[model samples]
Target: MSDEIGLILCPEARYNRSPIVLVENKLGVESWCVKFLLPYVHNKLLLYRQRKQWLDREALVDITCTLLLLNSDFTTAWNVRKELLQCGALNPERDLYLGKLALTKFPKSPETWIHRRWVLQQVLRECSPPSLDRKEQADSDLRDSAEKTRLSERLHRVLHDEMKVCADAAGRYPSNYNAWSHRIWVLQNMAQGNLKVLHDELSSMREWVSMHVSDHSGFHYRQFLLKALVRELSQSLHHHHAPWPSPGTSSPCSPSPDPQPAHHQANREATAAAPCPSPATPEDQSSVPAMPQLFHQEMELCTDLIQSFPGHETLWCHRRHVFYLWHHWRRDHNHHDGQGCGSESPQLNHTDAGLSSHPHTASPRGVGLDRVESRNGQAQEGQNAMEVDGVGIPDPCDTKRLKRGPPDPCPPALPSEHGFVASVLDGCLSPEQGCFALAYRKWLDSVIGQ
Candidate 1:
């Protein structure tokens, strides 16, 4: 089947061989024939791989598509396509379309996502401009610049399309691990340290997770974004002082994230900004939320989600990640400052399945979110009013002017993690039993010593 119409017809998650009505854009294959269809395609591809007289390259592509759309995890069939791709017999875009269609029914298929990543890397390579000599550049600077722009636009289009494909697969299957993982890989490979891309993703995902509260993978992707945002913020500062890489060459891509330069160093106790020789102007800071404000907004979101949708373990788990990241960021800052963790800090614990989380805490230090500083008015009106557009706005409820005793003690110190967990536990239906809440409470106690 041509990639332009490679959409799979299967509706079931399991083998992805269900029958669907044939359409202009979809592939329709009967499930009952899937049993006979696979063995036939398998033998035909085997003959082609063996270089049989009749089975040729076109026959190979035709049979592999039939095998993969039904069994998306067929590693050998994908490898055959990869061989074809390497031999210049197939286009990267065509293979990407094939992978997207394979993912339609088998959202969690490991090999399908893997092949997609490989194809994406090939696309990235194609997008990179060839190195040129100084004389060549001087001769055609405008042409070179235009060529670079074309490559950049092509890469951006592919990046956005891949993100959408991953989102759709994730939506089709809750906790679709392969989908989210591939999305992360694409960002790290294609748009590393692009703050605008990260911000856009976080904004769109906010609404997606709101609708799919039980999808743990969606929340996990959000956590990845939060980490990436902080890392990018810190990296921006480092890059400001560091010399740029040569314009003629592109940086080599890493398959996974590299060891970052202690990103949390700049974001202290989840409130303070990085101590810099020259502070960034307020206008420069306004575009990004203060680190504390980010955490506060996230905490508020967790509270609202838990209160609105009671007893979802995923919601409670999401809350755990928010606290865990906040706690660790503060500790990293403390370590950077030569002041060790205080008595209230969370002990190091196993995070994310069985992996050891490098440095993360699940508790706050000193004041809670109530007293945190703001860059975007995140419920900080009770604190000293911030200067706006060169004018320091005085507090409307200043005791000396309004005759009120005090501005109400900073909104009762936001709520301690313990208190927040207790409130969530209190709201759960008895039949629902709030097991997720109880588990989260136990997590707080064990990790944060709350």
Candidate 2:
């Protein structure tokens, strides 16, 4: 790309020629060229689009691609592409590929993500089955079943590629709001209620966030997945073990004992009376994943990360989220006694990993060096605070729940969010008492305590 043939003795950039820099399979166009090239392509594309000057589809596609790559923020360029998409001149997957390339450079480009979502919606709509209800599904013919399987496979491939695209974009830009938000959108729309897909995403993000510890967006995405899992488990547990009616209530049906032979009764009684041989028995290890255990494990992760990477507001914010979820979870459990719950995991003790507090509150407001995150998520990013796409954490100190401590009759003990926070402050000397730790404490007391 470096045009060096006619050098002006010093090999310097001039009006007609600019330098090109290449790094590891990536091309970097210097600003000298961008200043001129961008306006040329942009004006050409806009003029054609506005005046309907160029009805040539190939020229439109070519010029639009150049303009978008130069400035994906150019909404008119994206709209022109959308027009071509509507006319069936552009393939959805090809357009998606273009968006992926655009995101590689501009991972936080809202316009690029918006266009991508539109194209992805088309792909999803094409893959959806037509009028297949429960009865039809149950009695589907072999051909229909085969077609559904093929369509499912295609969707899975599309989602897998999209996940890769999001991951790459997230890596390119830390705390990438658009990339992570798009990731949430993909799961909610393409992989909704798919437990295995959710599990895989949770697994992959662990390694990713460990390396990018300060990524608030990544942590928020994790929050979104955890909520989905909680909702799923709660629903399943309710259906599987529906409560029995009270004996005091009137009943039309009679309850009769089984007429079993004496030997058979004796054998059943012998089996019923026998206790489980060991705590590790397969029967005792229920297949149901414990919701509380998951939360506790998440707590462990948060605390560990906080100690390891001191001074990151993202970690503290993540801690606040986990604590809020756990607190509300216990509150919810008390209110709905039979909600699907698992064996409680032990409290996450602050491992005095010799991690004493230090101070780094250089920024004003004592916010530390952590990246800023938008509290009110944008609608287009699919970062809505609703059940399906919600990535928000609840307020930890809601007073209604504070006054109504524990359930009516009370249950086994668990550490409160306050107790947990106190332990973290006492055990770890974050920053030798840095700005983030102190600010977090003040937030708990002044903001939350209020």
RMSD of each: 12.2, 20.4
Number of the predicted model whose lDDT against the real structure is largest: 1
Error of 1 at 114 (Å): 1.0
Question: What are the TM-scores, per candidate, against the unseen true structure?
Answer: 0.69, 0.63
How well does candidate 1 match the true structure in TM-score terms? 0.69
Runs off by more than 4 Å, candidate 1: 1-21, 237-286, 334-415, 431-435
lDDT of 1 by residue, 1-450 (tens): 432223343444465434544566655565556667789898887776677846667877898888888788889899999999999988888888888887877888999999998887677666655666988868888786677667767777788789888998998788899899999877766766566677778878988988998998899999999998766654453334212111111221111222454433322222121111112343444456645556667777877887887767788788788878766654453343232222232223333221221112222322333223342265355353576676767666454647744422211111256566565566657545377777776786577643
lDDT of 2 at 147: 69
Q: Show the lowest summed lDDT stretch of 10 residues, model 1.
A: 246-255
Q: What's each prediction's clash count?
A: 3, 13
Candidate 2, which segments miss by more than 4 Å at Cα? 1-25, 28-32, 132-142, 239-288, 338-450
Model 1 gets an lDDT of: 0.64
Model 2 Cα lDDT, one tens digit per residue, 335-391: 343322222222222221111222221221111112122322243244334335444
